[model samples]
Target chain A: MTEQFVAELRRRATIYWEKHPFQQAMLAGELAPDAIRAFVSNRWYYQASLPRKDAAIIANCPVPAVRRRWLERIAYHDGAAEGEGGMADWLALCDAVGLDRADVLDPEKVLPGVRFAVDRYSAFAREASWVAGVASSLTELFAPDLMGRRIEAFRTHYPWIDPAGLAYFEKRCVQAPREAGHALEVVLEYARTAEQRAACADALTLKCEVLWAMLDALDHAYRGHR
Target chain B: MTEQFVAELRRRATIYWEKHPFQQAMLAGELAPDAIRAFVSNRWYYQASLPRKDAAIIANCPVPAVRRRWLERIAYHDGAAEGEGGMADWLALCDAVGLDRADVLDPEKVLPGVRFAVDRYSAFAREASWVAGVASSLTELFAPDLMGRRIEAFRTHYPWIDPAGLAYFEKRCVQAPREAGHALEVVLEYARTAEQRAACADALTLKCEVLWAMLDALDHAYRGHR
Candidate 1:
């Protein structure tokens, strides 16, 4: 079964090879209209809904200290109107992508999978223990690398995209590491036994799969396969 | 946004590459003590929850003809008795795997992401049009191929895993193609507008991603990565 599980993972991972080199060489000046547009549109679910998932995790947290920290982090990501948290900054990037503010705000065009995946993540957090919920978010392990490549690539390959369009990536660079670190600490500290640790590890992997799956849907639906 | 989505998918797909192929190659044969144990243990979610997802889709069906057909299909999969349906058959496979039936039924040990992904999938179906929901289940497009390979691989590589342990896959051989055909017809017949066609395509992609994501998570949590 473990092998079965891993085989499954390998099959999914093979799809990501296409995104390399293209998304990796960036810095700030490299942003493109299309690329920025893609980022804004696709990341909307994550940017907008991540905190909600966090909130669910916080709500379910068995540990008060952990819950408090998560709530604060959630607030930080979802800041007060304008100039605040990640979402607004993400919009600026959306503008960089040429999407009208209204369109971005309007959920009509958003893909259904995005809605389900983000909501489901939050729901899982709501339903499961906070330890496991937090453990599942370990996809941040790849975020820093992905974010770093994105920044460098944006600066390098697609310069027409305004520097402002890079806001989301920049923020992720800052936020993802902090969030990942904190979430991992919680997992390592709180998951007390082998089974629990394995579970935690599984949770994190699951998160990665969710992210990967969303991307796969996008690629298949919108890109070369389509 | 498309590129990022694709990028993310690629990343998840990469994680799947790290599985121990040798073990997976053996997963289909006579039950190894380890493989059987893993199968029974991990399969709980697949057995326990798939019908719920199907029910959600069925509940959302608006067309009478479609609803009736789906209902019959659901019954066939779910069975009338406590120990019935494709899911129950899956559990019998679990027994073949090594898990006590009691533990296999308890969802507590299932990875939180698996629960979220599968539940999210069903929720996506229930929330959308019957056509759209049916479209989302095109993974059958890929299933028969995988099942055939699995059956043959098990026959050749993992004879320790009894053929009975693989009855689930055997059943899927007939089941998936029939279901996929029905679903494909639903989408093609109902999706008249270009946007609807696009949506149908997106739905199929989303389903694939769900499958892909599940696999990716397994790889991350169980195998080669951090």
Candidate 2:
């Protein structure tokens, strides 16, 4: 039954955000320079929000080993003492994309729609069962493939973007699978009941909605501009 | 200084939803029937979210007195049993506005923008300082007058609708002031330091933003539709 449930999760993964039009446009190298900048700026909000989401999960989870395992996610984004970690990589991407770091940092610069979506994502982590929260992040299961495609897409079509800025995606190529594997192990181990398994799938769907809605915000704001 | 901070919170209340254009239109009875239905439908999401927000506060708070006081909020919305409290009042409002009960319960019926905004509000209560969460409920301070106005508006302008549905607003007119007073006392008594007081005020501002954003979603979706 667990194996079947895993199959169901994989089936549901079709809605994973690689299918979002904005991501498709990026992978196809169809996004304009400004579109790329808008994407980077808006996505920065998600990257920044992630540490809080992970911390919320850790705070809610009962098991010490799970909490210890999850602690790395927060550290991965926030770093040891600032100016480091995945957040720093994102800022580098922002710089590489020619966005002003100050503008990227400004809360007002984030579209209301993007703020709404990201807040919902963080809220789900804070409110849902710990296993469900971990399940929602199984989007990482699909992330490595998209990251690889994104790296190649940027290199081939958007060559003007400094290759150094791609470090976030490149690192994620290694990190996401490892993280997803751990998360999957946790969810499979802990979500033993039928209802619990279904909730994990629903949580993943919610996460997918979050990602898709965020891109929808970007698409609305920058799709037609220039 | 706390008095001054309370004044600051009052001053910031200018952005409250009563000032939102959608509310302005509704008070003027300019909303079409469909607009009224959409408002009732979307606003139900906010109504349903309140109990969980209150529960999250109770869960996070250390003081038993505070927890005991806060528990009433969840009860007020959810009632002693399902289908008997503010949620029932809202479903009654939906029926009076010509919406199906099942439709209101259906998650898919909610607008993405409204869901995003409501989720953000719930998340704030779950994730912020317990005092700050209490402070956010300070919108109740301004809510009584709006509830009064809403009752008068529906009776005078939208008279075709059954007056029975107005029970929610009418109850709020009485309940809000009392609730707000308790919330203020908690904020004033517990938020002792300057930084904590500022955070309390900030939480109020965030709550105002949530209300305004919900109206914005309604305005976008039902503004022009007949």
Candidate 3:
């Protein structure tokens, strides 16, 4: 039953943003520098919001053992110290991609549409049941493959970007599978009822919508218009 | 008993960072602009951490009614939209105090000690009981008085800064007492056992320690040393 449920969720990846036109333009290296800059500048808001979302999941979780495991995600993104972790790596990517790190950090450039989608995800994490919030993070199940493809695309098609900028993707390629596997196990264990399973699937769908909406906004802002 | 508990927590204000030498130096106008800049930069981490902390408290809270009320804190800091609210106001303060908004947002200037203290508070909110986490926010109970005094000091002593920057403090002066009152009511109503009351007091003390530690790091960094 759990395998069937997981399979059902995976099948819905048809709606994932990996297939979005903006992502396609990115992968094809057809995006202009300004387009890529907009993507990076806007996505920084989403990246920065991850730790808070994870912390919310941990807070909502009633089990101590699960909370202990979930705590690592915060450390992963935030790092034990400054100038470390995925966020710093993303900033390096921003610098390598020719967007000013300060501008990205100021987040002055993020579009309203992008901020709305990211903030909605954070609010969902805070408001949803712990199992559903964990399920929402199953978006990670799709991340490793996309990250690998992204790295290859960057190297093959967008060689202008420094190789160091790809470090965040490279790290996530290793990190995402483990995270996704753990989250799936938790979801399968807790979401036993049909209603719970449906809720989990709905949460995953909402997450995909967020990613897709972010791309839609990016596409609207940068593609053809620029 | 509740009033006595509240009094005991209030008495701990003897150790609040407002009484710290660093704060005193700022009030006296004895600190250099660089020192004030460093304080603003480091404290930005704390201001930025507020919404996440509030979200954590809301996530952990079991009652929907309380969660609904608790949700307001996030909105108060994050605002109904970007370029609004207390975080934006703090950026204005940053601008007035001579730090670049980009630098403040970049968060590159955050000291290790300050980061540790702020991160510790966030973690406490995530891991501790929801009531305790809410209790920690009782520091706001002391905020209205401190904010009023700080604003007066900034205007009278540190006249170099633009008055617009004081907007955050002025706004908080009105907001804090109401927030603090709500939180105290929740704490007093819910924390029925002696043990729960003690835990609340402990959480408040830990919060005070975090603030003091941040100031200590600021004092060591920019006060006649580096």
Candidate 4:
């Protein structure tokens, strides 16, 4: 049953945003600089919200042992110290992509659709159970593959964007599997009942929907009928 | 002892940014429209972070009764639904102040100092004891007096801004004392030891520093000499 439950989640990867039209266009180099800029600018919101989301998960988890394991996730994104971690790498990517750091930091360019989607993800983490919140983050299970492809595509196709900006993807390629493995263990351990397993699956599906919706918004704004 | 602790916090109001030179200038009509715009843009980040901060406080709190009371703070900021609450009132003020709603919502204009200060407040809430977190919020205890003075200042000195933009201040005037009252009760009840009382005092002082630093940044950027 546990194997089947995990497999059910993996099956839904068929609809992951990596296969979304917008992402395909991005990989194909059909996206304009403006489109790429829009993606970078808007995606920063998600990166910025990560520590807060992780903190929410830590707060919700009642067991000290679980929280001890979960604390590393916050340190991973926020860094153990200043000028480090995933957020710094992401901002570096923004800089490499020619985004003015101030503009990206100030985030004046975020679209309504992008903001709504990201804010919903944070709200979900805040409102849901610790297990469900961890389950939603299981989207990381699919992330390593996407990051691998993204690095290759950006290197081969988007030559104008500095390779340095792709550091976030490279880091995630190494980090995602480890994080996902931990999350999977947590889900497998806690989600013992049929109902809990189903909820976990549903949470993964909801997370995928958020990613797909983000891409949908990007496509609507930047695709230009291509 | 509790009364003495509360009085000590009130004594620190001597350093409140209301008495800061920049705020004094603002109240005196010495600031340019650009300065006021900068203040509004930067302050929006603080406003945007409030619901999330409140959520952290609620999540850290283990007691059901405290969570129930704390839940209202989130609702007050985020609204019972959409297009309501303090956030909406703030955005309306943004609009009244002639800010492009997109610019404010995109939040690209937020200053580094403002963002740092606000993020620190959120982190403090997430990491500290529930009682300490609640104590930091005691800034609201001094808020009503500021809000009352601010409404008068804006009306008398900044007539160019729409009266409607001042709604957040008006709403907060009625809201601050009540919220502060609840927070005080929590602090008095939970912060029983001398060490706990000192920690609570320290939290309020840190909060005050965040607010003061925000104004300092604003003054540095916009004061443009006497």
TM-score of 4: 0.55
Deviation (Å) of B5 in candidate 1: 47
Off by over 4 Å in 4: A1-7, A10-226
Interface RMSD, Å, model 4: 14.6
Q: Which digits, one per residue and each the tens of the lDDT, describe model 1 over residues B1-226?
A: 3344324423333323113342352343433455435535664665554544554454444343454455445555556555655766777777665577777667786666666776667667656766767776665654446677767876676555567777777888888888877876676677777667666667766766665555544544554321
- State the lDDT of candidate 4 residue by residue for A1-226, as single tens digits: 8879889878765577888899999888788888888788888888887766776876566443455466566667666456678888888988888888888877567777878888888888877888989999887786567888888988988899999788889988888998899899999999898888888888788888888888888899987844
Q: List the residue pairs that clash in candidate 4.
A: A106-B107, A106-B108, A108-B108
The order of the candidates by lDDT, greatest first, is 2, 3, 4, 1
- In order, the TM-score of chain B in each prediction is 0.79, 0.97, 0.96, 0.95
Put down candidate 3 lDDT per residue, A51-152, tens digits, no spaces: 768768865665444554665676677664667778778888899999877789775578988999998998898788989999998887965589988999
TM-score of 2: 0.54
For candidate 1, please provide the TM-score of chain A on its own. 0.80
Displacement of residue B142 (Cα, Å) in model 4 is: 2.8
* TM-score of chain A by itself in each prediction: 0.80, 0.97, 0.96, 0.95
Which ten-residue region of model 1 chain A has the weakest summed lDDT?
A: A17-26
What is the DockQ score of candidate 3, to 2 decimals?
Answer: 0.06
Q: Is candidate 2 or candidate 4 better by TM-score?
A: 4
lDDT, model 2, position A62: 52
Docking class of 4: incorrect
Which lDDT tens digits does candidate 4 get at residues B23-129?
89988888888888888888988887776676687656644355556656766776655577888898898888889888887755788888889889988987888
- Candidate achieving higher lDDT, 1 or 2: 2
Best by TM-score: 3
